[model samples]
Target: MNILLAVLTSAIAVGGTLIGSWSTYLFQRRTAERAEAVNREERLRQERLAAFSTYAAAVTELKRGLITLWFRRRRALRDQDTREELQAAQLDSDRLGAAAEAAAFRLRLVADDPGLRPLMTAISTHLGAISHAADRQAVIAIEARFEEAVTAFIDAAAARVQ
Candidate 1:
């Protein structure tokens, strides 16, 4: 009888230990899963912010490039070389427009400011007018106007953001 009692107690002790270990394993697995989920969410948010920043930077670069080219060409430039550089700048501006549209749609960047859309439209129109001009003289006449418009845009954009 004593031997039988000892055997039963030993078996119960082993069973209890196994149950405790399984419970601990399950708890650890759940905690790890929760942590992974949180990490995934954080990474996704950061990716979105990064994408928005890239789009904004591209747009700024386009404006800066066009403005810089305008300034460079403004200084007693000959008709032939000025026209060539203007064409190149226009192409860069067009690419930036496409990127802006994509970013706005994909990232839902429709901000409260009404001027942003019009500014973009104006830039596109200015470039288009320059591109369609029949002669260098026509384009050269509007070069200063184009430069002023872009400068104003930058100023207004800064104010609006603030």
Candidate 2:
């Protein structure tokens, strides 16, 4: 009887150990899953932040190029060599605009907010206007509008990542 009692106690202890181990495994698995999910979200946030910043920088570069080309066009109207230089500047501006558009597309892919699309579109329109602006006054006015749209986008992006 004593032997049978010892065997039963040992079996109970073993079963309890197995249950404890299984519970611990399940708990650890859940914790790991949660951690993984948090990590994924953080990574996505970083990606979106990068995309937004890149797009912003590209837009700024394009704007600067357009402003430069506008001034060049005004000054180079009478000079043959300056006209060639202005043409080169225009080409560079075009390239910058294309790059900015590509960056915007990337931002669209990573942006979780649907509202940002319209803001981006508005910024693009302003940029287009700036590129084709005939005078310094028009460029200045369009630049102000572009800056506002950019600020709105930045604010929206900041809210999203937080």
TM-score of 2: 0.91
lDDT of each: 0.62, 0.87
lDDT of 2 at 21: 100
* RMSD, one per candidate, in order: 7.8, 1.7
Q: Among these predicted structures, which one has the highest lDDT? A: 2
Q: Identify the runs in model 2 with alpha carbons over 4 angstroms from their true place.
A: 80-83
TM-score per candidate, in order?
0.54, 0.91
What total of clashing residue pairs does each candidate reach?
Answer: 0, 0
Residue pairs whose backbone atoms clash in candidate 2? none
Candidate 1 lDDT by residue in tens digits, 118-139: 6655655665565455455766
